[model samples]
Target: MFPDHTSTHADTAIAPGDDTEHHEGNPRPRAMTSTAEIDSTISHPGSVRINVKGAFIVDSTEQPATPANGNSTVNGSYHEGKDIRLPNHTAVVSHIAVDIGGSLAKLVYFSREAHSTEPGGRLNFHSFETDRIDDCIDFMRHLKDNQLALNGSKPKDLCIMATGGGAFKYHDKIKKALGVDVLREDEMACLIIGLDFFITEIPREVFTYSETEPMQFVEPQADIYPYMLVNIGSGVSILKVSGPKKYERVGGTSLGGGTLWGLLSLLTPANSFDDMLEMAAQGDNAKVDMLVGDIYGTDYNKIGLKSTAIASSFGKVFRMKREAEDEAEDNANVAQDHPQLDQKVHASSNNATSSSQPRGLNDMSSRFSASDVSRSLLYAISNNIGQIAYLHSHIHDLSHIYFGGSFIRGHPQTMNTLSYAIKFWSKGQKQAYFLRHEGYLGAVGAFLNRQPQNWGRRGSFEGDGAALEDRLRARTSEH
Candidate 1:
């Protein structure tokens, strides 16, 4: 289960040369206005490593005046050959790509500060809720417009490459908002390609997690092929990645991250998926889950089933309610002044039900504690997915299993549950590893699909081809 990690690193080549260029416009210097800070990592020219400590700023001082209506002025106001002085007097060359999905829209764009002193290119990653796609469009449009102003060249007609369900579902909306043509990419292809890039180029981008042992980093091997990828996004998608641009949808499950969020939200007051996961880490699932010991009164050692093993998730609720009902019935038969009966009735209904049945056919207040419900639901889905993934891996003889998607998000319990399930199922034969940027694989895949087939092994993005040049383009002025 991949939760939501957002670290992104890009390999870029900044054309090193003189950056000073003459311009014509002589408008008065406006006061520098602060803008929203973007989190980005720039790789040194021709380097694969990402320098996380260095900051790359996209100077917003050159933005056009806010229109009277508080909107970006019509594209007509922008004309070719207009010298808009950029910060450091260097042109910023950026190519933008995106993957818009049911829940989130991911963006991976490259930018280079036009000076040799700033040697590398900046690869910035951004995301927005799919419902707020307009925000994504606005951000891209601003970048596109800025790119135009920097070079005094007409915006290139590069189609914005995209993948995921939203690519088709919201095509027209994106086209209208950004004025850029939308190029659809196969979702599976995007995922595989993105996985390839992470495995091959990004260092320390994958790792294995287990509760018993400390988290260990899984180094990406040069010959690492034929691994099973279990992506837990809204739903799970299992792929057998044989090589670059080579994969097959071997198996999947409908109950994935979407299930966890949808189900847990109903039982808990958590306002977000992260909040639910945090609550789950503190939860004691033993209170809500029926364990083997709870039923047998001892370890079921004959079958090798531990006493602490879960017999039925959320199973204790029914048993507790039945016991409460029995006590209530017995109390009715007893005298009204029977002090012991009153105490038993009150204790069973108040304490037992309160702890066991957080939400049931009874009062809303009877709903299970957020932590317990969260922990149970998290395990329920993780175990289910992990078991299925292991079974598939066993059948296919696949040794490696890398879990990616927005489900694990580096949550210790979720990863531990997934790792434990795989370990238990494989019986020490295999383990579950996770990606650093589990959430952005689809978007990264879309970005990589624009590259040539053998581009991954070359370890360089230039000269082989202009993979993104065709799709990562600016829209033309309609008027």
Candidate 2:
């Protein structure tokens, strides 16, 4: 069983029948004897070592093969291993931690070797849309049933850690579906924990993104304190972190991924979030947005505003619509005033309209390109988030800002806009950082919550292997 705690930061107590022994001056419990030699060098992101039959098995395989069930793959594969044991030698055959948001439900779980009681296994990451909650449940059920069949017995414990708003919203659904108590962790706490682990323990985890240089990995800072974490999901949350568990909700905005998604869904024919992003990638926001040049006919040098800078998102559409309406009205008046000339005027109008139609809001497909609309909204949202994040950082005087959440999805335009905003507002003083596994922060944090504190420090396994093995044996004796 996992450590029992009253709260996320509360002191944890070892569960009954646990093999670990507490040591004075050491936060993590140690095993009586070392049964395995842990290695920290793993060629994977967020890789951690766990004792497995006195051996360490690192998952070095590429992306897992997609399931035939048509479930989308995010980071980790589901069909990598059949029988994976939960860490810490508990009787829990299926262990999973989820971060369910307004849009996406991210999952982090361990998949171990088949029919093996080994602790070492692959840590897999997956995500599903919140609207499609059944798919996520089905995937979890698949993992549970597969483990049951391979182990030939029902698990004594089924551990499920959850976070985010959907953790409570979908708590009963998950518990009733999986038949296990859903352990809820604080969303903000999990986000900080997950982010701290990645920045400190995982190499090449944090990087800077910009249009000039797409991604440049940043080395872990020697002392990473007084930084800001801007998590952009359905909404935005800006946090000021002073230490590992010390943070405060500084500022945020409701204009985030949901705003873009909602606007795009209504304005365009995009079927999914990814589709909208694809449309954005192929779009030119200038076509839909009103720029400084559109307003001033040139850059406002006195105010330092570039001509190409966006003055208003979708601002030109209004004027274009008015012009189109006026032309249509005038044409109708002319046709009414002159009966014989009506056919000639109508034919000329048809030819002129066919030759060059004014870009307006009247025609859905012709005037407003889905790509242009998608790109404009994407820029609007990203720019707003970036500016707000910079403001929080400035007020708090935090130089380092890390951006996380599913909204990013490592999209080039989104990252570029965010990075540019930070640079422009801060005059190149403050930097915006991004994570490789940005979307799974909460999920990974929940996953780590099940393990001992500092269990995955520096990507090396530090625990009592003898105690783990003994616990594994004791659990097997019952079945």
Candidate 3:
């Protein structure tokens, strides 16, 4: 629901004045080059948020070189430091993290005021977005050319943090196209890692309701210890996150963003997922939705079921509307001319304008309005998911619900609907915790893969980084 993604306010901190030193030893400072000379058609700093499925942000002010240039990689590069000290080195890394979904590929990179060799400076992160995978590949190649074309900037070791179904299938193409290695991750694991980080790190990124204005959720002192993680992606995947590296595949279902997107795509004239939601906002489900009265012709008195309940799924409303728009034109003209003064008379006739579906599902191509379809779609998916999640929480006897993935990028109505559903279902016992950087969970994992908890106890995860550090030493002969 949080709409104003003002760059003025991101969840990052440099501990003001904490930055002072560069790497203990490194090469001569090179002049920054003009990316303009390289190619001018690429977008820098990718996506601020992932789509409906659990994905990561790929928008950033960073770019990779083109393929023809030879060295410039599209995904970005990676590097290691001579010593595992305070400041880290990653300038050589091209693309730090990435996730490829059915229709989109996300790229994330870190931005440092000084080189990664520098001490403590904030890493301004961003991502890239594209409907087609080829576009992303071209982008990485462009970035490589631009970086190499720089006066002194050299290519760095880049690790491709990839997830989703395409990760395994597209691994090689990603590697060859970007000229980098893909660090494959468990789709669910990435979700958990992302959940843990969001719960533990950023304050105010999450908000829970109270008697007063919603409190900007502060990270509980030990929030990540254990929680039930529900990743609402292309589909839903639930996990019981025990710790950073310890989580279990708890439960999930087919009812997910894909379901909503798919149904709307076929049933409504809606184009994008956002468009579907816009129309649904004004659409009365009574038109298409099956009602209880249509079944028993009365309330299920024994169970206290309302007479107007949804008895059967997809049982009614095939035409999805009572009357077509073209037929209603005559009535509108007569009503406009009369300008009827009787309020009661107005109620006598079923006003077609107030109660009518679009002429037909084919009308989707008619036009795209700044519609509320996005909001409606969000509610249905979130509400259903929330109810299902609440059921799981109740079944497992879990308390905390950590919602992670690309789909929950601060969609307010979705969050509100979900939170309310959880409250209604749990009677206010359980709460749904969300993260700000919803999609980059896997990329962050790939970034933190070097941590001891990950890459096994010996910690080979940081090898790419470490090897690069050693190479730097051999060349510059610096400490």
Q: Give the candidate number with the greatest lDDT.
A: 2
Off by over 4 Å in 3: 1-95, 114-131, 145-153, 209-215, 267-271, 274-377, 450-479
TM-score of each: 0.67, 0.73, 0.57
Q: Residue by residue across 370-391, what tens digits does model 1's lDDT show?
A: 8988898888888899899999
Which pairs clash in the backbone of model 2? Answer: 31-464, 84-112
Model 2, which residues run further than 4 Å from truth? 1-94, 113-120, 148-156, 338-365, 451-479
lDDT of 3: 0.48
Candidate lDDT (C-alpha), each: 0.60, 0.68, 0.48
Q: Which rank order by TM-score, best down to worst?
A: 2, 1, 3
Off by over 4 Å in 1: 1-94, 112-117, 145-159, 301-303, 324-367, 451-479
Q: What does each candidate score in C-alpha RMSD?
A: 15.2, 9.6, 15.4
lDDT of 1 at 83: 15
What is candidate 3's lDDT per residue for 1-479, written digit by digit as tens? 01111111111111111212112112134232243521221222111221111212222211111112122234332111110111233222333556666533545544433344443222223333334566666655655555443212444544456776777887898788877667677666565555554554334444563323333455423334556878776688887765545677878888787777776666566655444544545544444445667677878787656675445444443433333344355445555566553334457846443322332333433322223333344555676788889988898788888676555544444566677777777888988776555545665544433211121112322335443232222222111
